[model samples]
Target chain A: MRLGPWKIDVEYGHLALVIVIAGVTGFYLADTLQVSRNINNIILVVPLAMLLLGLCLLVVTQCIRFRKHPVQKRATQLPNHERDELEQEQSPMDLLHAFLLLLGVGALVMSYPLIGLDVATLLFMIFALLLLGVRGWLFVPIYAASFTAVVVGGASRLLPYPLPTLLF
Target chain B: MLDSSAILGAISLLGSDINIWLVIIPGLLIGLIAGSIAGVSNTMAMAICLPLTLYMDFLPAVMFLTAIFTGGGYGGAVTSILMGIPGTTSSVATTFDGYPMARKGLHNEALGLALMSSVLGVLVGYIILLFVVAPLGNWVIRLGPAEMLLVALWGLTMIAALGGKRLSRGLIAGGFGLLLGTVGMNTSGYVRGTMDIPFLLDGIPVVPAMMGMFAASQLFTLVGSQFLIKDKAARRADYRRVLSGFLSVLRYPFFQLRGTLIGVFVGAIPGVGSSVGNLIAYAQAKRTDKDPDSYGKGNPKGVMAAESANSSSEGGSMVTMLALGLPGGGGTAMLLAAFAMHNVTGGPQFINQNMDIVYTIIFGNFIQAALLLVVGLGFLAVAGNIVRVPLTILIPSVLVLALIGSFAVTGDHAGPITLFVFAGLGWLMKRYGYPVAACVVGLLLGRMVESELIRTWQISGGGELAFFLGRPVAMAFAILLVLSLLQPLIMRKFTAWRTRNRSA
Candidate 1:
């Protein structure tokens, strides 16, 4: 089944997820194995082993299911199970919009430590408001600046510690 | 035996501390508003508000938080009835009939029924909590480490059930979470999966991660929507119709009672709270009704059934948190954080030592229930208007608050960074139908599950397989786990066989 507007395959996504999890868990499992094993360490190892095993089963079963039922037909299916030609084209645009939103937000988050919280947030808000199709340059700057100031200023005042930022 | 002194002392405790009582109203108000807004879940509200609790004493902080919990259970129903959007998962079932009712211009009636049912549900849930928690606490005190592990495992199983048909995905996500949970050093100081990062040494900051997964991810999804409710005329709130709708709920006592019962029992189970309760209750009500097909089509009973069960589930969840020290779901996970903040462990020891505090929480809920009826009316009068606010403005605003809230939690860049990372992760998981709730249950309960597993292993003398046989309760749990895993698969096969035979 496709989830959300992005048309991401649920089964394949889950398979990919489990594989990554298994790989990470295997790395950790190897580390614990190398460590000297006491009774306490043995206790910790048991659950990790179980988790590793569970991930393996999840990935394998998902693979079998995927093989039994190929992805093409399911991938194209809309949530309402309707076959509308117009919507088929429309959803991809929606997906692109969603991707841009996520990318913008991600970039802003990464910038927090690099550039600073206040400056990054102000830029992010302006970008986000524009991305969401909020027109009028006058409304954009005022909304972005005021919102960022309220957040940064209010947080600086109320928070138990100072926010990580180079400039207000 | 009930302690008369504890009862009297609890009453006196509230009477003495005006601050404890004062915070409850604001807590309820915040919860009501947060819950009424779709995408601002009770968990997010509690998490965002959690930092504020750091300023207060233990009792007041907890009371305030719990008051929010109580109000939020009902607040979700408002949006469910008024708009098609469910404010919280607890209210998802409500929208089945509630929105349809609103479509028929019975919006006022639907809102009223939802409100009345919610109030009664909260009252019934806490009333059950009042009777069950103390006795349950005593019984749970006798449970050994093995049994505790089983309890944690049972909670994990509930996560799968919460995923509906996405069992494999849920289990895998939960497994990943358990692995992530062990990233930090164990009790023996052996670190497992920190990847050599200093910040990762203590493990993922749970509150920020939870806020990201539950709140921020949900907000991102709503980012495309123009407004919460598309219809302008439906957004108007009529007090007279709301009143009539409120009184109309009294007509369906059976639905309310059934829903409340379902909400309480199911909600009491760790990891399965109001979200499932409302669904099961609504299903039962629909199945048993004279016209089963009438469900999801403006049925008043459906609204009552869903609202009552979901609302009462708050009390049910509280029972688990107070008596067992295990959170029932994400909302209570935040409460558990509050407990940690207060240096208060919720369990039999805490219960026995501080019966007065326990009783105070219950009694305060009773007052909250009464206050909810009054406060909720005022809230409903204004709640409908929020649907008119555009998501473009709402999303950025809430995201900023969430960023600040996370920062407040960790008092470092770690908070905001974690929030951003998990939000992206959560959004991806949601988009793929991986069951973010399962991930949440896993992340929140991961430490407890592993800790209990280690404790059991230690008690059993270093991985002794025979040790399981000695513990009857743990053995019973083990049996339940095996059955829970196998039963679904077996039932699926049987259904296939039956369908094949029927076709033949």
Candidate 2:
């Protein structure tokens, strides 16, 4: 990962992500330019153009950096010890856990409209506890249920409107 | 406006009302506790307690809610400093330096600084509000759409300055955020970026998005850590150190005053209030400081500037609410509701006819400001213990709060969904060298800038250049903007020249 006294340790996956994001933004900007000349459209186009420019520059710079540091291109595939010493070790399990928690949160949100707030919250809380590395099956339900009840119950009483839910 | 009879009436009204005194402490305590929690907002606390106001007399009801407002103003700083999760938008900039200070084992000091600055800010804000309620209203109204647009632009320049070493990366993140902000429907009935999603017609909710980016993403970064502060000794709260931190604010009276001024003016502006005020004050404090580079890296003054500006904005926002009957934001909206419940109307006529009531409210706020000093110290002492909580428990618990909080914001699933999506984006941005702060700033200013720009264009009949040229206030703001953009480079070059001269 060391290239001419500069240490670069970006993974290939992250680099590809940068390219993808930049490409999407650039595409959006081009599409927006063709829309119109109204005040609202112009307002939208200016910042979108600026954003695309910034993203393109970022992608170009990152590409140039990678080009300059050919040896660092395969830093993600480095032998374990070398990678560990150079970059703070993030295990694949840790990455998976984080990603799973995120997915669980998304699921929790999407399920709310389907089932209801109360049920969705109860289910999500338990799922979140598991994803967050909570153990003891007995405590999980107890904690999730009570937490859901308090939040959902409080919102029901205090907020101006009833929180949408299928099952109370 | 300041007739002796009015002053006497105000004093007598306040003195006769034992009920007003009774509710102040309890209301403040509720606010402090609710605000101290990561997801619980002052507005939420007030909303929960709003029904209680229905039973009380008019002055006591308004006084009670205002007490909660004052206490909650400082309450958000606790978690922002300790956990890097801003309990409210007002405390967002506080996270920049305050959290770093906490990580460096100065959590107690940051809390004390925030509290003291808040107390002073509220005090100064009320004092200014008392004298200039009418005049200030007239003055701020003179700000045209062009001027307001410049104010938002002024905020954006800070993004480049916010990016520590990677200015370009910060600009990229900020630009992306600006683009993201424009995703929903525009004022002109055109929806550009919302892929035909029905809910997005109203645009992405800013508060939930903010919580996900700053709070949840930050928690993700802190995974595997047992304690927030790595230093064991720094983890414990020291009362003496807290006292020392309280005393530290006196050393920078000018900084506090500057922040107070910024807060009052910005807070008076309807729609854009304390949220923008705090950021602008922090940026100004950083830009003017001798060691501007030290800001956002555990600097005490940064905490002072943000807290002072935000707290003082309460008084500024009140000016519009009381004198103009315009609710500035959520908290003030609650206050306006209280006014309605009391069978009172607040406008120019209200001030003219009910000067006694106006004086009483201002006087009550002064008392609340004094009480904040005492109640806030104890609250800080207890809230500072958050560092001792292990990450395993703290993370899940805060996540729960954040989820519930987002849910409360929209009273729908949209809030949590936005939080989850943005949390992932924020995590990745943080993982890279992109300045999340810049993106946040961009997100906040994006709508305001565009709206103002459109308004200016409409007012000018498409002659935007000539309109801006005619507006002296906008011209002044433009000059300020150019100076702000050039200041850092100018300072750096000046310093280099001085260094060369010294060496020679």
Candidate 3:
């Protein structure tokens, strides 16, 4: 992308992170002020939230400047074709794996109270194992079931509070 | 300071009871197992075992509890070195370097260094406690809100130091953590940021949040990796390397001594204990070293400094419990409960009348420290095999365990919910260049800093400058904090000047 005679490679993920930080800071700062403007109440929150917002702005500025004047590598450092191959090998599949795992965990936690911890855990384990490329349907269910049994069973006995469960 | 008659009586008391000897190993084993698990803390371990102590005698009961205390101190370091997860808050600093070392296939050495440091820390802490418990207790109690506020600020200086090349990102993460920490209710009775969650009334549950940030976040990052240690040959748990790491600790006496002293003094303070002590020690070690940048990247000194301080804090916390009947942290609070169960109060009178019992406890800790050296070696040998597990199996398993552990910590749906939310936040922060450790530190100290600052303001008649000027100790800490903040710049200048002079 070109902006005012300068070429830049913008990383959307990094930019999104900065935006998220700024949004959280703004929300918290506004909420704190709404609670009260009393010095004692807002002493820690007001200053910290402002500091975070300031940092986000500074980071955004640095990101643009650094992207505009991205560091140049010597021709002898690596052949262009090899560098391209290296970048290809890195891939984005790892990210997809992470995202899937995150979703799996979220589903398990959200369903914990509704479906019971044991069933939720068993479902999460199977989903995770499959997503991570574990094979053999016979092995997967057995492994997931036994592991869930031991963990939930042990936790049920050890923990003071009862873990909501459907099956013993 | 030495009571001659009490020392002799303590020796006799130790020899008179065989039951005390019997419970020591079991207590240590129980503590070791509990502390190595991701979410289970030494306090939880003690609480679970508290009922069993009711059946034992007073001396044996205290001895058993202290044995657990001593063992749990080092046990947290196990998972910290093997995995990125810190088993307890006290081992947070340990993960900063120990985890890096493990990733580099040096798990054996890191575990050995942690074990040796913990043993010596306990020995030195107990020795110091024996001579100066009374005086230290008196001095520590004199520290008011002003001093504690300074101490919290001193720990906060670590945020800047942890920033490395990206100082602003570190600050942002830390600031975000500070704001998040004050989520539920303020000390002044004004609430903000709770989002109407009832559990937020007590503030974010720190242990569960920590489990998400460190353990679950790291597990997410490890999804596609083949193994924790990429090189198959390097994953073996070699006893020789462990021994070498053990022997290497003796060479860094200065780091060990400094960390132990910081642990003792910081641990003696009520409401602030090993969690902050280890951070302060690690920060000081990094600041003072000739090569400060090597710290977070896997410096042995970082592990040594953190472990020594956290382990030694056991004895430091004992000074308050023994001399003033005040518990410094949860572990000591459990000990206090056991004291109540046995119908023996701990105060100046208790110390004066039962001097032998006090000495007996200290001496028993000495033995426990020695036993830890042996038992800890066996435990490390078994625990070191974590590197061999493939990431396919390890990642989901650890995530599930962390989820369960978080639930155990908070005892409700809120714990799992918090863990899930923080896991996503931690992952994003890590994917960017933000320092999660800095955020964790900020969260830990946020409530403390706010409460102390409020108290200081109230005591100083609305935050008067003259009130701070009159405090010599606070002034001293302020000066030290300023100097530490400036140390990196000064060192840079000095090095540049030396290089120019040498070239000229």
User: lDDT of each structure?
Assistant: 0.73, 0.80, 0.86
Which DockQ-derived CAPRI band holds candidate 2? acceptable
What is candidate 2's TM-score against the reference?
0.89
Scored by Cα lDDT, where does model 3 land?
A: 0.86
Highest-DockQ candidate = 3
Task: Point out the higher-scoring one by TM-score: 1 or 3.
Answer: 3
Q: What's the ranking of the predictions by DockQ, best on top?
A: 3, 1, 2
Of the two candidates 1 and 3, the one with more favorable lDDT, higher being better, is 3
True contacts kept of each: 0.47, 0.28, 0.73
- lDDT value for candidate 1? 0.73
Clashing pairs in 2: none
| Candidate with the larger DockQ of 1 and 2 | 1
Candidate 1 lDDT by residue in tens digits, A71-120: 46553565532343223232555556666776776787778888888898
DockQ in order: 0.38, 0.33, 0.69
Tens digits of lDDT, candidate 2, A1-168: 667756665666547646755765776566556565666667655665665676556655664443453453466888754553345334677667766767766787787777887897788778767766778989889988887788778767766657776654
Across B193-251, the per-residue lDDT of candidate 3 in tens digits comes to 88788999889888888888887657877777788898898899899999988987999
TM-score for chain A in each prediction = 0.66, 0.67, 0.83
